[model samples]
Target chain A: MTPTKTAPQNDLPEVYIDDILMTLKYFTDEHEVHLKIIDPQVCMNCESKPCVQFCPVGAYRTQDGGTVQIAFQSCVECGTCRVLCPNSNISWKLPRGGYGVAYKFG
Target chain B: MSTKEKLTFDVIVVGAGLAGSAAAAIAARNGLSVAMIERGQTPGSKNYFGGALYTHSLLEIYPDLWDRKPPLERPVTESGFWFLSKDGMVRATVQGGKMQNDPIDAYVALRAKFDAWWAEQAKKEGVFIIPKTVVVDFIREDEKVVGVITDRPDGEIYAPVVIICEGVNNLLTQKLGLAKHDLKAHASALAVKQLISMPAETINARFGLPSNEHGLAASVMGDVSMGLPGLGFLYTGVDSVSVGVGVTLEALTKAGIKPYELLQRYLNHPMIAPMIAGGRLMEYGAHIIPEGGWTTMPKLYTDGALVAGDAASMVNALHWEGTNMAIMAGKAAGETAVEAHQKRDFSAKSLSAYRARLDKTFVMTDLHQYRNLSHFLKSRPDFMNTYPAFLNDALGMFFSGFGKPKKQLYKDILRSLTDRRPLVKAAGDMIAFGRTIMGF
Candidate 1:
């Protein structure tokens, strides 16, 4: 028998809302969260920019002039951009407690 | 306090993920004073999965949970298996009665909320959950594990039994000498998933669900991985979709394939594109699942401690079921701990009952039966590369009517199978696969 009809829908609120609220609270003092690395020039700044496409929440975006920018507020820290990136441009780690994407259904 | 204020509990459970929460819940329910420690800020903040909860084992633990409001999104009504080629899909579907039942055959959930709900349940059952607390090391009294040392200030907890439900990265298990430190990449699978947001109505309509019902599709990318051993899946939830790909880390390293690229290819596939179109990607995460099954399971019990969940490597990948096994193992471990506490014996000999209980249960049975399947799949490149292409080719020819008769289509299919491995090998593989993994 097909198992499609039996899936259940949760009535709770979206978990990401909490994540967003937490992010807001975490970055209340700062506009942007920056990463410290040995060399900013290490980023090859690939024309295609795979991180922009791989980011689930569009935290990484490419400007018209082809510069990559990260909006830390939306970053869920799923680590996809770091693992998928061909170059070691993104230094990823877990977000502070009560911050980042709070999945309601995870 | 000299930075060493010691605390005590009847049981100490590490990692507040699904399995740990279940273990803590069961232990507390059995009237044992329990301490559940989590490294994350919350129970599920660090957890990731292509989430599907098989309710069988959960119902065994909480029989009346479904009678009230379940922390479930949608009841899965349909399931599909797709063998995908470069541009086409060869499909097989199973639907109806047996899959829909009282305890809910399966439910898709977001772990962050689901896990928190589960942890809250455990707390209600009298589990003292210490969140944001990292268990740094196993406190050894002689050769036996007597307690754990947390990173928190004044955080040494003494317990007769410590249940390690620490997921795939079992550092403490290795440190405590319960499991081997050197886990081969072949034994681990790297899975990456994304939660895509969509309107609930849109999701239900797109997946053809009636009201709150849901659908799931598990796809095998034949030759899509360039001969890597892995698969992809997409599960429909209430307001979103969970889609991901998992490949053996060794195979991925060898092939130089990126998991996200595999995910993109999966999403772009003709068969998958329509279903997930217009959905905004909401969350993305990755995890290493111990796919070694029974062979990789550690020494489950040691002096003064027991192991459960992924720390014990209890995942059953054949059915894409791990959470259920983890929950069941946790429950069993909790029951065993309770028994030991009553008898006041936490020696390795007494705690060995956890292993016995697991052996008699479906967790070990399923794991042992499918123990060889991962190896078989890893060894057989054709299962990942050739069969999918052949199936898609045969199906394409069978369905196309380009001024050709049915007999001609049959001849075309026979021709497609000629240069490939002999039909005998395919038949043998199928039989072996059914016997070992499917237990048929």
Candidate 2:
């Protein structure tokens, strides 16, 4: 019952980050920002700003004046930002029960 | 029930994922009251995996798992790696006839569906599942874990033994000083996946499979990660496919690429696009994999507490195995708990049996064998960048040598090897690869 080999020619598909996020279901906790920027000044001084690039959902975005904005609504809770932020500026905690991304087919 | 009895149990298993469920079920079946805590709305709502479940470990918990007809997607029959170089791929696969028979090797599964089903089975075994609750910290008494403090009101539940099956973000493990520190970017991998919806017939056709029941689990290395230390994977589900890439967090950070973008490049690759062409995106998710291996594993046991699964860094990264290790370790921890209760001693010395039990199984054996691997791979960037492309180029030359002399073709392949790397460096690569595999 193994998969057989086959070669086929097809056009490559285009992917949009926002379009991908649209397909997911999230029970947003309006009151709680489970993900927080512990020190905005620390983030501003941090040059690499790795969280802006490494976050899977792009929840952390840089504003015009150099501060980072967090759209915690879209967070998938991978916890990468908490660990990868060079300054350890992000305070991350689990969302309240039933209040985060609920994968339908994970 | 008395208030004391209502708030107490023999064991409290945290996280309700594969490991926690397995631990609760085994302990409850052994006549110990078990409470399993889950932070998700349901057991698997907050969980994600690489989409394959090995049957050997599950069989340890449910001997007749296949007969039970679990919510498994498809039995994986063909499994292999697709060595990719930007525009081309060289596939290597293994499909044994016996692997397709009874007691199948592995099955592709969606964690949401499969883990929910697994938790239900645990409940049936008399395990109390507390859903929609997060265990924030351990309730300790005299430096021994006596209970857990959750987010819910009056949520302190006392248990002599606590098993932490919490996944890769092991805050509790760190708090207990089990793990040396918070996970470093280099020590963990962030994987993002998209579940693509397609008809079963379309899936079968695209994959060149004989029937809907069989599936393929193919992992792509080399250019899939843009020559980075990561991999792309495609696992066939019943009516869909799971396509994803897992790259070390440090690699992703250093390269300045979003994980989803890396996944996008993999999806658009020439060798992969065709298989998933007409499918619609269903859901997207991300999870961190503990890649610290044996070197950074948290202390497995403490007085009245034990750690299992990703919390203990039990993943065998080389084989792409975590769930199986989690399940087996959980079962072993459950057995150890049973022994501890009988002895009426919950000291760390008594619970050291948990590690002894794992030592007898593949969980500890394989981890011990590959203890040096993560460090080896992390330092050797050329293994992913130079070797794969060189192999592909040499294969292309050999396959396209229709009118060329055989001697010239052999020389051409040798020239290609020296063109990318010095012969000495190539030999060094071989030795390093051998050491990685052979543990020399």
lDDT of each: 0.72, 0.86
Best by DockQ: 2
Q: Give the Cα error of residue B43 in candidate 1, in Å.
A: 0.9
Q: Per-residue error at B270 for model 1, in Å?
A: 2.2
- The lDDT, on a scale of 0 to 1, for candidate 1 is 0.72
Determine which window of 10 residues in candidate 1 chain B has minimal summed lDDT: B252-261
Candidate 2's residue-wise lDDT over B110-143, tens digit each? 9998899999999999999999898999888899
Model 2: CA > 4 A from native: A1-15, B1-6
C-alpha lDDT of residue B146 in model 2: 93
Best by TM-score: 2
Each model's TM-score, in the order given? 0.82, 0.95
Per-residue CA lDDT of model 1 for B82-196, tens digit only, reads: 7887678787766677666655588887787788778888898999999876787888888888899886666688998999998776767777788875344677777777678
Top model by lDDT, which number?
Answer: 2
Instruction: In model 1, state the lDDT of residue B332.
Output: 87
Candidate 2, clashing residue pairs? none
